[model samples]
Every structure is written in structure tokens, then in C-alpha cells.
Target: MFQYYCGLRSGVKPNPSSKRSSFAHKISRFLKCCIYFFMSCIVFHGIIVLYGAPLIESVLETFLFAVLLSTFTTLNCLCMLGPNIQAWIRVFSKNGAMSIWDNSLQITTMCSIVGAWLGAFPIPLDWDRPWQVWPISCSLGATFGYVAGLIIAPLWIYWNRKQLTYKSR
Candidate 1:
């Protein structure tokens, strides 16, 4: 199990295919996640600009919020997938085999995103607190949602993976 990610301890070398299971492969996924996170922020910014959201703050502040939001967004994006999404992406570009993620993963991910979005609801209420500022409440909500989803998804996956559904006349 450990060898899958860490590879050999000493002078032993690793094979090319085994590289996918290496530790570096798993951790490096974060780089792609960061890109997705940034894109998520960009979309949020576009909404803020177009609708003139009440959340008024400096660019840096908003960007901070975006970063936080992106952190979880990337997390949710990566949580579910058949193969390392990065690997799947590579295959897609090169026209190789396709990896399909099950519905459970998608369900888990959407729940995470929904959780983060719902985080914004607190800001509109009359509660008085420094963290109640624009993006702060929303970001908190997002984080909370992501955590909740992360905790619950395994159970969902466990239960879901066992069922086989069919429709017949």
C-alpha cells in the first residue's frame, strides 16, 4: 500500500505506469486544483461585477475571499473521479482511454459546492460580527459545506456503490 504512493525506499527505480500511483502524482494534483480554484474565483468576480452584489470591499479583500472559496472549490472538484483527474486530462488530450467517474462522486462534489454557496446566507441577516462582512460569511458557509460533504460522502458512496438499479416493463 505504502509503495503505491511513496515508491521504493532505496536505489530501486520505479516504472512509468506506476508513476500515477506515486506520492508526487497525488500531491501534484494540487497544482491543477489551484488553477480550477482561480477560475472559480473569476466566475464569482464576474457575477459580483454584473449583478452589483452588496458585498463591497477592496480588490485584495475580495481576492482573499476568492482564494478561500477556491480552496474548497478545488477540493470538491478533485474529491470524486475515477482516475486522477490530471491523468484523465492527459489521456483526453492524447486521445487515449477515458475514465468515467460514478454518480456518487458527482453527488459528493455538487453537495460541496452547494454547501459553500449556502455559506453566503449569513451575511444578509442582522447578526453583528466582523466576520459577517461580504464574502466572509459566504466563504465560511462554503468551508462548512465542504467539510460536511467530505465527512458524509464516504457513507453515501458506501451505500450507493452497493445498489444496482434497473427499470423493466
Candidate 2:
């Protein structure tokens, strides 16, 4: 089922002529998605560390946070855009004009980042709650933001679906 959804996002139309070929294609795409997911996790981990996440003091938490953030952004984006760097660039770096898919990616990415940023706020506060630990609050915030994006992006696209016209550059 997940594979089917991924295939749809990556524009893998069903080939009525060959079930064997279709199965092979889906397996290959699924593998590619897994690879991209893990690679993005590592990249996000390094990025988080650079952004002041602890390396020596709390490696596990940092890595877990990376996984959480990656799940929100990288995994979701991969499912939407596949492994095509060109598609990523087109959606992420091009003009504001976008298809529903591109807009969804942008919204999800922004929400996750903002969520993580906002999550860090309580860390320095003197609230002294158990959830105030380094990345706990941030993770919760990111998760909430991601959920919000998932909800809002669709509604936003639906509300504006007719107004925007996306052209391939």
C-alpha cells in the first residue's frame, strides 16, 4: 500500500502490459526510497549537530532527533518527489508557482523547520519540566508542526488549487 502511494507520487503509472515489470519497478523504487531516507538521516544529523546539537554529551538524543526530523521532511519529500534532485530543485528553488505536490513539500519542510526551531525555545527556559530536556520539546514541536503541515497543505492546495498554474522549467 505504501509502495503504491510512493509510486503514485513518483508518477509510476501502471503498465497494463506487464505485471512482472511493474513489480520490478516498484521494488527498485522502494529500495531507492529507503536509501535516500537513511542518507538524509545522516545528513540531517550532521546539520543538527552543526546547529548546536550535542555531539559528545547526548549523541543518542541528537541522532534520534535527526531521525524524527528526517521522518517529517526527508521521508515525506522522498515519498512525494522520489530521488530526483531536479524535481527537488524545481519544487524547492524555483519560483513560487507550484503544483499541489510541490506546494505540499514546501509547506511540510517549512513547518518542520519552524517546529524544530520553536521547540528549542523551552530548552533554555527555567520551566524545569522533564520534557524540557535538550531535544524532547523540539521533537514534540516538530511532530506537531509536521502534522499541521500535513493537514494544512492539503487544505491550502485545495483552496488555491485552481489559481496556481505550474509550468516545467
Candidate 3:
């Protein structure tokens, strides 16, 4: 049992002279995929928000919210999935893995969504009538988003550490 546990942690040698699991390669690939996906999403979202069709500004705002929600949900699911994937890799490739962060990001994201919805000002996009609505709406929306992220980030970090400590015990 101890040897198996050690094997899972240390993993198998890569080459006859090197020590690294094939699982490490898979993990690197997965990380790369995630980075690519995240970057692409950022680029696409930025383009839609900044330079979308003039008439579609309102639609873009809503679509942005939906995309953010989906991303948050997906990341939350990944936190849960990590442990299972680690277990599978441990068995198949004799490599142990653990996720560093808990699923506290989900909570922060929910809180941010609620804050945005209930903020004193609402988000809007009116490119045609900039003087009429765009400035005020964008100002308020950006302020709300910034404040929400600030508040949620610390709480998330604290909650994550607390959960990790509790689980460790």
C-alpha cells in the first residue's frame, strides 16, 4: 500500500534515465487547452463588447452576461472535476495530483452577479445616444463591476483557505 502510494506521488520515469509520468504530459496538454480557450473567449468577448454592431449593443451586454455566467459555471465544475481526474490519472499512470484552489470562485461569481443586478445603476450600451446614456451607464456599470470584484476576491480567498484548512484536518 505504501509503495503504491509512493508510486502515485512520484510517478513513473519518462525515459530510462528520466523520471516523469506520461500523466504529466497529459496535464500539461490540458492546461494549455484551458489557456487557449480562456484567451480566445477574452478576445471574442472584447471584440463584441467594444466594436460590435451599433444596433446590437444592448444584445451584446446581455450576451456578455450570459457568457460570464457560463464561464463561471464551467470553472466551478472544473474544480470538482479535478479531483476525479487526479484519481483516474493516479491509477492509470501512477501519478498523484491535487487541485490548489477550491470552488470558492463560484460563490464570488454569484455574488458579483447579484451585486450587478441590485446595484444603484444598471448596465446599458447605447452607442448611438452616447451623450444621453452611454457615459452614465458605462460609468456606473464599471464602478459596480470593480466594486463587486474587489469585495468578492478577498472573501473568496479567505473562504478558500478556510475550507482547505478544514479539509486538511
Candidate 4:
């Protein structure tokens, strides 16, 4: 019985090498995600407030507006670019490219909102000003960032590989 138990335990245990890499990779990814999220939030909030836009007059309205807008916008964008982005991500990761599309998209979207607020006339119920500018600019910026990432990723990967090869030699 003891021998059987030991055998079972060994079989159930994870491979130590893969476990270490998995943990390290998770930690690195998490740190990167945190930095990205923090920066995006700061930029988003700063732009909204800086533009003198009224802070959602009511708490419920603000919450609802944020939820609705985010959901709709995310869904729309995902519908348009979700597959392409996923494919690009897979290709870039496989090629060991330093693809910054994910990061840049977030940043540019935030920047667009800021730009909209700055450029738009902030009048409640006035669709002519802020609403019009924000989405258009955001979409344009998102596209620009994506295109930039594609161009930059290959160059970055090549440069890094060159550096590595040089150091190894």
C-alpha cells in the first residue's frame, strides 16, 4: 500500500522545470499587465477630468454610462479586429517579436478620449461636440497604433536577435 501511494504521488506531481518557467512567466506577464493597466487608467482619468467634462452628474448615471459605453465599444471593436489581433499575436509570439499592439491600443484609446475631451465642446446632450470627436479619433488612433506595431515588431525582433547573437559570440 505504501509503495502504491508513493507511486500515485509521484504521478500526480508536476514537472518541476515546467512549473518554474510557468510561475516566472506568469509573474512577468502580471507585472507587465499591471503597468499597462495603471498607465491607461491614469491617462483616461486625467483626460476626462482635464477636459472640464462634468463628472457623471449622478453616480448611477456615471456607472451606467461607463458600463454601456465600454461594453458597446469593446464589442464593436472586438467584432471588427478580434480575429486579426489574435492571429497577429500568435504570429508575433511565434516569431519572438516584441509586439506592442496590445499596449499601444490601450494607450491610444485613452489618448483619443483625452483628445476628444480637449477638442470637443462639453455640453450636456450636445452630440455635436465631444461624442462625435472622441469615437472617431479613438478609432483612427487605434488603427494607427496597430499599423505602427506591425511595422515596428519585425524591426524590434530583428534588432533584439542581433543583440543576442552578438553577445553570445
- All candidates: TM-score: 0.55, 0.79, 0.37, 0.32
lDDT of 4 by residue, 2-103 (tens): 545334556675567866887897677666544544444445444444545346553343333333333323433343344344643543353332334433
What's the candidate order when arranged by decreasing lDDT? 2, 1, 3, 4
Model 1 lDDT vs. the true structure? 0.58
Off by over 4 Å in 4: 1-15, 56-119, 122-169
Cα displacement (Å) at residue 166, model 4: 23
Scored by lDDT, the top model is 2
RMSD per model, one decimal = 7.3, 5.7, 9.7, 11.7
Clashing pairs in 2: none
Clashing pairs in 4: none
Best by TM-score: 2
Tell me the RMSD of model 2 versus the true structure. 5.7
State each model's CA lDDT, in order: 0.58, 0.85, 0.47, 0.44
Q: What is candidate 3's local distance difference test score?
A: 0.47
Per-residue lDDT tens digits of candidate 2, residues 106-135? Answer: 998889989998988889888789999889
Q: How many residue pairs of model 4 clash at the backbone?
A: 0
Q: Which residue runs of candidate 3 sit more than 4 Å off their true CA positions?
A: 1-12, 15-61, 71-100, 119-150, 153-164
Question: Which residue pairs overlap in candidate 1's backbone?
Answer: 5-23, 116-142, 119-141
Which residue pairs collide, candidate 3?
A: none
